[model samples]
Target: MKAVTIRTFGGPEGLAVIDVPVPAPAAGQVLIRNEAIGVGGVDAVIRRGTLAMYGFEEGHIPGSEVAGTVTAVGDGVDASWVGRRVWAFTGVGGGYVEHAIAAVEEVFPLPADLSAVDAVTLGSSGMVAHFGLAHAHFAPGESVLVRGAGGSLGIMTVQLAAHGGAGAVAVTTSSAERGDRLRKLGATHVLDRSGQGGGADAPAGYDVIIDIIAGADMPSFFAKLNPNGRMVAVGAVGGRPPADFGMAMMAAFQKSMSFATFSAATVSEPDRRAVRTAQFDAASRGELRTVVHELLPLEQAALAHRKMDAGEVFGRIVLTP
Candidate 1:
């Protein structure tokens, strides 16, 4: 079996393509022959060593999202899934290989109409978006503001919020190109963070704010929420441990709003199953569209990591084995 493994924590160059024996499934696990793999920003963070202290043992495979066919089923597992097409969240690793093993419970059958490319990209990002939107408790006619609306998760957030009956959906992107994409993805209003006029004169209140980039802009995002509104923090791509929270509290107090952060690991099993089912249903109906920015072979995984780290691509990038 061929796989990309990080022998050392450094850059994309650190990921070496090597031939290794195919892994056999353990008890209650299934071995899959991977067809497609999702490349995420966190993979880049791990490669760049920003997240190195988290302690991923050497020779680790960095992908969490995978879509493939089960080739072997382990003890105590149903054999019916052997030929089934599935997509799964492997948590932190084991998706960047020709053959990978996953616990049977973590796998979900993919819709017949959806392709491997789309299903692989849905991975954690789509699930997280579904979780965040549900947490926002969006009611009919409520409004939402999504920061980083150009990224893969941001695009899903925009579509889900609009589909859930949001009265107004506002999205912010630092790239002008992404502004156009966000509007097409159901954003009622698009703000370009790079321009002074984009978000500067925008409305000051929204019922919900889904912030993916939560660093220097925390204060500004807090100010945009309406009284009693909820803000769900999903990512800190810009930076972490944001400066003073006094101003945010004052703003929140004025509006009686609440702020919360989500880690995918904290989501319950039932919720995870619900999210996967809902997302696949949406995909089958053509309601959920995955924007694939690039697709590369498994050997080119390092290049994919570079592109994601440079922030030059939008939507999801998938790797085929």
Candidate 2:
């Protein structure tokens, strides 16, 4: 099988496509002939060797999610899974290939009407947005602000919050055109990437903040929360915040505001599967939106990463094999 692997660390130039042995499914796993693979921020992080401390090395495949047909199953997996269309979580690698392996528990059956690109787009990101809201104890009437709202995860947060009956759904994005596009997707207000309104005054404060960019500016967003507001940090694509970023919460002790980081990794397998299934169903039924920026051939994996690095991608980029 052919797979794209990181031959070295740093630039996307290091990504190379090469032939490799087809991996066999182990016990409780299934082999998928991948049709669509999701390219995410985590992939770029891995390619840059940012995860070196955690044992991510050169020659690693950097995709975490894929959607395709099951070719075979290992011991303990049901035979019925063969030839079934499904979405699978490939953990941190192995998904950027013609064939990928995933534990049976990580696979979910796709709706008949759902396309492979849509399946991969909403598979893992939808889980994060759904659980992140729950983690923050979000209430339907509360206002929401999704920071870094251009990518798949942020885009999911915006629509989910609006569909969940949020009073106001605000987003921070790069361009006015993109903001207008997001408005059609349920965003009530759009702020620039700096989290500031163009001319109109920003909302008094947000009741809940879904922050994907948690860097030095994190403290500023922390201050925008209303009383008893909760802020959930789901990604830190902008780099880490200051060492004393938490001090702002303490400084405004009377507000009862809170801050915490969240990841879908903390959720139980059953819970993750259930939520992902629901999201896929919702999308298939047209109750939820799945934004796919583009579908590229698997060999263009490096080009996909380059677009992500340049902030040119507006939504999920799917690679077809």
Q: Please tell me which predicted candidate would have the highest lDDT against the true structure.
A: 2
- After superposition, candidate 1 runs with Cα above 4 Å error: 194-202, 243-247, 250-252
What is the per-residue lDDT of model 1 for residues 1-321, given as tens digits with 9 covering 90 to 100? Answer: 899998788778899999989998889999888899988877766666666668876688889888889999999999999999999777688788988889898999998998888987676778888888777777878988898777788888898888888988888876767888888888877776621234554556789888887767676677777888888888776656456854676745767888888788888888899888888878888988889999999999999988866777789889999
Candidate 1 RMSD to the real structure: 2.2
User: TM-score per candidate, in order?
Assistant: 0.92, 0.97
Stretches of model 2 off by over 4 angstroms after superposition: 198-201
Question: What value of lDDT does candidate 1 attain over all alpha carbons?
Answer: 0.82
What TM-score does candidate 1 get on C-alpha atoms?
A: 0.92
- Highest-scoring model, TM-score: 2
The sequence of per-residue lDDT tens digits that candidate 2 reaches over residues 48-108 is 9877898999999889999999999999999999999999999879899999999999999
For candidate 1, the per-residue lDDT at 32 reads: 86
Per-residue lDDT for 25 in model 1? Answer: 89
The window of 10 residues in a row where model 2 has the poorest summed lDDT is 193-202
